[model samples]
Target chain A: MKSDFYEFFCPVKVISGRQALSNLPHEMDQLNVKRALVVTDKGVAGAGLIRYVEDAFQGSACSIGHIFDETPPDSSNVVVNQVAELFKQKNCDCFVAVGGGSCIDTAKGANIVVTEQTDDLMKFRGAERLKKAMKPLLVVPTTAGTGSEVTLVAVISNVQAGVKMAFTSDRLYPNVAILDPKMTMTMPPKITAATGMDALTHAVEAYYCLQKNPISDSLAITAIKLAMGNLVKCVENGKDEDARLAMANSSLIAGIAFSNSMVGVVHALAHATGGVCHVPHGVANAILLPFGMENNLAKRAGEIGELAQYLCGREIPGDDRAKAEAAIQAVRDINKKLNQMSGLPNRLRDAGVTEDKLEAIAKVAVNDGALIYNPEEVTYEEALEILRRAF
Target chain B: MSQSSNKNDSRGLDSGGLAAAGASAASIYPKAKEPLGMNRLFSLSYPVKRGIARVALLALGAGFEYLSRHCDKLKEEISGWEEGRIFALSILSQGPSVTMKKENGAIRCVGEDLKNAEIVFYFKNIDSALMLFAGFIGAHTASAQHRTIVHGDIGIAMEALRAMNIVQSYLYPGLVLKKTFKRAPKMSFGEKILKAKLMLVLLPGIAAAARR
Candidate 1:
């Protein structure tokens, strides 16, 4: 059969340590750029991370354009266009994003306006649509997950259409991904857990993606191990730098895995929920994970059993049926610990999902592009069952 | 110690195997592997069964739950089967059987699983016998006797060659059997339906891989 896989990496220099924020200017100078545009939400802009970038660029060739700080939690196209207008007006040579997925995605969208000279997000919705590079984009995620800093995916929600338009292109990847745990130290435990679960879901889905190859499988396995070991610990103790750093690594690796292999029905369900009820993407995935894995388990018992062996860290002498269940139980154990530590809902009903909406949500999830790659066929009725279980 | 052929009467198995074994199997079908390839990977001795190729390729890693913890017998059954890790694995089979028509440099043979050769391995349960047939295909895939250009484009073919070399370096001696592609055995009604449904589940990956 023919293969349609394209692998590309964004060229970004990570200069991180205790004084990692101080390294940006020198790296920018080395890249030979004289001007920088600091893109972020007003909250982060007010926190003075932007000043660190400004102070570092004092004597170097780098200069800061006016900070575009009106970013929302879920940014809209208007905000992206507004930032792009500033990019052209200030003649900004590069972009420095000091926030989460939202800020970084805003910068990616704003870059399109600066170089591609168009604001149509629809034009670049599929693969390899943009053949050229955008201006140098730098992302420093304050949150430990959402590896937008290192990913080629730029997710933008078109609130008008109620669909999260996923704009994927190699050109959209940030040039530099600065992963400094200290940057994430200020996040609330809830925010940390939400993002961490998001990262964990990425790893889980990648491990099960039908297109997974040896390379992606290795990365997904490592990422999942990290998430299982550290996501909860970091959430419980916000000041623990080690756990924070581990989650950062987990998020980065999972991003790399899913970005290459794509995700499955968990993501398909999340996409539907996010589009319809405006649920946070990670929250939807967290609620559906065990259910989705169980449904896929009947047909894909072998792969699940292999994964179970890995999760158990040894071959447990038993029937394949028992082994597969053990692997899924491990996921539940992680979720249990995560909930105890982070305080997120264990079910959709707790997250405000109602039975009235289950059928519609399931129908939507069934049609999602991600469902086609699911380990098992999630017929329209099965999706509803998953929702009912979660609800 | 035994080259045994038990009736695969799924409806009756797991109970009184000795009494019910031969009644249905002997009259309805020929002996397995009359057209053998190798092992379950491919029994050239077995007649090319329906959709067997697709089931083997897609299910290369596809394992359903084991019915029992009795590993010794199962291992003995599959002991001769080639086992190794591969970079990327694919399976395809003929759709509903049809007359073969000569086309260009090759012949087009259509049937139950081959409806979509571009994504042949995506077919479902196909047949248990077919999985072994596909194993034979994978084993001989790089061998001279079964070597067919994996892809028409030079770059894709080169990639296949690279994968083949990697497989050779990392593979155990037993798994070399899958390289020789062969025809598979026929299937029961349940297996055929399962294979058809499973094919659609895998359809997305085909599109995704092609795009990549």
Candidate 2:
């Protein structure tokens, strides 16, 4: 279905291959920068992934000025200011973010602070609020999900305000995103399964969301096919560089798709679940994707049915509703397989969410900005119903 | 390129010489052309639509103030809001705007005062604002179509949206409501009477607000 009006944009140059990291220094030089601040989390540093980034800079004009590895599982405003302060103190010219969504978002938040020369980030929250050009940012994902690499949005929690501050702008898109198989080669089977499902959810939701357009739909379908083909393989064999690279590409492509098209109920619920229960984002998304699809089935059957070929790997023979059901079932089948393979939880309760928290999660989900783009209206009651069913 | 070079060379001339060159150019150059017919029509329509949008926004603000006093559901919806939390709906870039503040456990229309609004829903242009104000689309559809950009806590925005939905149910007829709202509201006999009352007093309220 074509929309009457839509907008799409992606300016991040993607570099994906076996040794994509080796091109980092050259990319920095292209951006006319010499010293780089490497932002990462302790987990990625602990897993010895920083060495690959360090090795990429060796014998090159650009060098690592500092490595701030204190990024928590969730990026916060405090950490963002800390990173900006370090960027200035270390005299870094650009940022190279290595890790998952947290690291990338932290780097983005810091870029806003550094470029805007503001210690208070709360004033810059919301869409297209950053007027100043950001410092050059290069992202390398150590996980195959959270597609923060290509997205123009960053979520940084304000500890004092007790709310997550979302900053969105075209300027927030990184200058380059490097997808090296070696970076994600260390992901465990469970994390790989979870993150792969996260990418799948991104592609699926982007396809049926209200903002879907021809360009985004094409990218979304390709991403879905790549994820469905490579997710299980990557989970089964973490050493398979081909499958790892494919998943990396899948995540990046899905990120671009959702960044332009935006996501819907699945991400809304997933974010709420993650915020309330401390559940891993991928786990919540993996559990709720099918339910979210089912929630939108009545309004988006045609769009959902179109995903059948990409998700199920074959044309489904039925009406749109039946095909949509098959498409959803295919997702469930993948989840079930991942559960058997890596114990990825297939239900919210099993993923550490208690039944009592469903209502609170529903309340938060209704307030999520992503819900605005949902094809079907998701009120508090509808959101609660979806949560109950997923639970 | 030669003309541009000549203009650049003129920059080196004295002020009197420059003024004389400018006068000569003004006399030599053709008068500015009138806008194309279609462009002229569009320019003419802009103010008409902007006027309609402005009147609609004033009525909307007045309606919120009226319903906050009479509508129970609206009252309940807004009761949880913190005191003095200001929100606004406005067209972008120097367009007429309306701000509402939660005060004394009720919503009060604060007119176009946007200085202290904690949350703002900015329609990208007058056309988008006219779409919603003219009842051509609902709030949910407006948001889904990306006709508006919200700047604030999304949770508070959603709360404001719910309240706006309630006010809309009373302001618009049932047929228009059916077309615009995601779920058409069902009003009781007393509520219907309240709606009738609101219809009677709304124009006068808008007039009073406009006068202010």
Candidate 2 collision pairs: none
Docking class of 2: incorrect
- Tens-place lDDT per residue, model 1, A1-391, is 0112223353546555555766777767766776788888877767666666577666766778777778888877778888888888898888888898889888988887678888766545533457776798877788766777877777776656555555666788777777777777777777777788788778777776555545666787888777777877887888888888888888888887777666778888887887667777777877777777788777556566667765665676677778878888876776676677777777887777777888878867765656545656565678888888778
User: Model 2: how far is A344 from its true place, Å?
Assistant: 0.4
Worst 10 residues of 2 chain A by lDDT: A1-10
- List where candidate 1 sits over 4 angstroms from the true fold: A1-16, A46-48, A159-163, A309-319, B1-212
Provide the TM-score of chain A alone for each candidate, in the order shown. 0.91, 0.99
Clashes of each: 62, 0
lDDT of each: 0.60, 0.89
**TM-score winner among the candidates?**
2
Q: After superposition, how far is residue A61 of candidate 1 from its true place, in Å?
A: 2.8
